[model samples]
Target chain A: MDIKAYIDSGILELYVAGALSEKENKEVYDLMLQHPEILQEVLEIESAVIKLTSAAAQPSKTNIFSQIKEKLKFGNKEVKVVSIERTKYNWMTYTGWAAALVVGAGLLWTINQNNQLESAVTTAEIEKAYLEQQIEEAKTNLAATQNLLNVLRDREIISVPLAGQGNFATTYAKVYWDKKTNSIYLDAQGLPEAPEGKVYQVWSLTLDPLTPTSLGTIDDFNTDDNKIFAITNANESQAFGITLEPEGGSESPTMEQLYTLGVVASAP
Target chain B: MQLDTLVSQFQKKDEKAFEALYNMYSASMQGVIYNIVRDQDIAEEVMQDVFIKAWNNSASYAPEKGRFFTWILNIARNAAIDKTRSKAFKNSRKNLDAEYFVDILQTSESLEDTTDAIGIKKFVSKLAKKCIKVIELLYFKGFTQKEASEALDMPIGTIKTRNRNCIKELRTIVLE
Candidate 1:
């Protein structure tokens, strides 16, 4: 590569500006390492940026470092050196005193250990209470899951598969109807996310007259984890159907958006 | 005075080497900080914090990842930006976008005594409006190429090449 031309391309200036992506930065860093001229160019660019930026500074009012040093408590070199020596001797003296202190501390620690064990027993009891609370929560979740499973697997439930139609033929859905509970679980896993201002409406139907009844709309369609919705339905129906309606379901189904239809099979 | 050796010494808590490093970059750091904070006292305070932070985290500095100057510059920029974001700083300073770094350089009375003060003053006077916007976004405001492109309403390639030409012009004025 022509290093000068590469440098002249102005990438190194952006590199100094810290405007380059990490990958570009690493590449420039490697190239700078490989070529001295590239490195020199980067240095000059950095220097120029520095000069320009520094000119924005007001007059040197006071040395800021001295204030920082004072905050950090390293006032002078002589004082630091003297402090270092004092600390060195202080370490030896402290160690001797610490040894004696440790023996006395050991006895105190033994007494403290007994008290700590008592506290540990109390802590264990508190932990047991917390564990019990978690178990209660788990039991409630398990019960809820079991209720959902029973609703899905009940013999009274009628399973209806809704195949996609029109522009969304690839999508498929299922409905589990529990006539006893007047509840239907509409599994819309195959449907695309509803557009910003639209929603899917479920309809119950009578085949002879083509009478349609609106079951409430699927409101949390996007956020539903399994895209399975539970809706209340108590309609005497020969068939079931769905349609794409405006955000709130229409008074009647729009036949053009009739996405799926499943007729009731004759009983054996 | 190998760079690696000096850096290693500074890492090992050598105050003298740390001071040497400080002397080398302090002015540049102050400039970068001042560009962001645009207050001398606050910039100087942040500069001190940046160096102290560099000292404390000295072992984290790796030459392979970036230039030492770049690493320190990142630290200075981050600290200065953090200062600007503080409740007190934000409450006191309003309409930060009213001026750019070139305006600061052109109008600063304190920058008069510096060696390249005249050169920078002349460069700012002669700098094109486009150059000022590009440099302001890329260097002073630390905008990425894509961001600079969007801000300047130019293509990414143009931002890059224009920045290159701008810096080239600046180097001619200052480095000469």
Candidate 2:
């Protein structure tokens, strides 16, 4: 058989793409194992396609496997509960107590079973709510991400990379200043969590005279997953800075606590 | 072989193996779903459902029939297409034109984070229109050779050879 000719026929690409029929796929599978070159070619094609497709993907905000794991875990627990009930039923028939005691124990067992069943129903409800909540969250996150992408892609939006400063040199951030909307999207993904009673405050700066205007405190920094906050910035500023301040922020910019600073490249 | 082992373990209901496979292909599946549904939220819902369905129907899978990646890819494509056809989806999203996967790849925000960022950019920029359509139909859309032939208004044999050549170019661009 002419292996090179067979390979050139492009059957392997179709095979990897699953465009082949069952019989054709089986033949390709058999040939792949038989010939190292065929197997190698198939692997390469698959890898390249995987890379191409993955480049288009926007990954989920939360871990999807954990959700699957939770589902599988729930299934296993239900199975175990069923088996335990079966074993308990088998033991119930072997009971031999006096009539009165037996009645009393039976009532107690009934109550216990009823309580267990109630709790089981409650658990199932909770699980259902949790799953529903997760789906809702995923939907909201996706929508938010899409909106963020659109905003970032806007032609008029200016990108400012705020480098870490002073003692907080390890932390950094970015500001997407949209002049049209009078808003700046601050992406503080690189900043560490604000300590208790301390909130990160943003500021618009004037470079020549070295003046600053407070842009308010980030109270929900700990809760935001992306750490990208959109704050109204109507100021015609020259630079941007972030400072750690006590909760509710301070009157003036805390220059000593300034965590990051960046000069706007094309400040108007 | 490692993938084969992981797939076999996944077939045996091994969570670890399933997780490994999910991590490996979830991005690709998301990309495929995103390309079809074109809505990130709907795509996400379809992606989760696809994997859960794959896990539930794992026993029905046979290695001889096709590769595991191909199996999951089929599920993703079918699920996304099904979502588009759903009444709720239709009502919410009116008029979903047939868009190529190349558009998604080029305009994707997360492109830089992908391992194939540079190669993919180069490939898409350099790829001919014919190659894009062939790849979009055959690979991303899971179109059969005949369907792709009809879609591209080309012969089946040409579809096969063209897909082969396109993939060959892809290999050079991405796997080199």
DockQ scores for all predicted structures: 0.36, 0.47
Best by TM-score: 2
TM-score of chain A of 2: 0.53
Model 1: interface root-mean-square deviation in Å: 1.8
List residue ranges in candidate 2 displaced over 4 A: A74-268
- Model 1 alpha-carbon drift over 4 Å, by segment: A73-268
TM-score of each: 0.54, 0.55
Error of 1 at A179 (Å): 99
**Chain A vs native chain A, TM-score per candidate:** 0.48, 0.53
> Tens digits of per-residue lDDT for model 2 on A1-268?
7889999998888888889999999898898888999888888888988988888888575556556666567345432322345668766755644565889999999999999999999999999999999999999999989989998999889999999998999999999999999999999999999999999999999988988999999999999988999999999878999999999999888889999999899744
| B1-176: candidate 2 lDDT, tens digit per residue | 79889988989888778878998999999999988898888887788799899989999889888888899999999999999899988988867565888787777777776557878888898889999989988888999887888888998889888888888888887886
Q: Could you give the DockQ of candidate 2?
A: 0.47
Task: Give one digit per residue, the lDDT tens place, for model 1 in B1-176.
Answer: 37678788988988778777877778777877888887877887897799889888999987666667777888888899899999999999986876788877877787778679988899989899999999888777778889999988999889989988888898888888
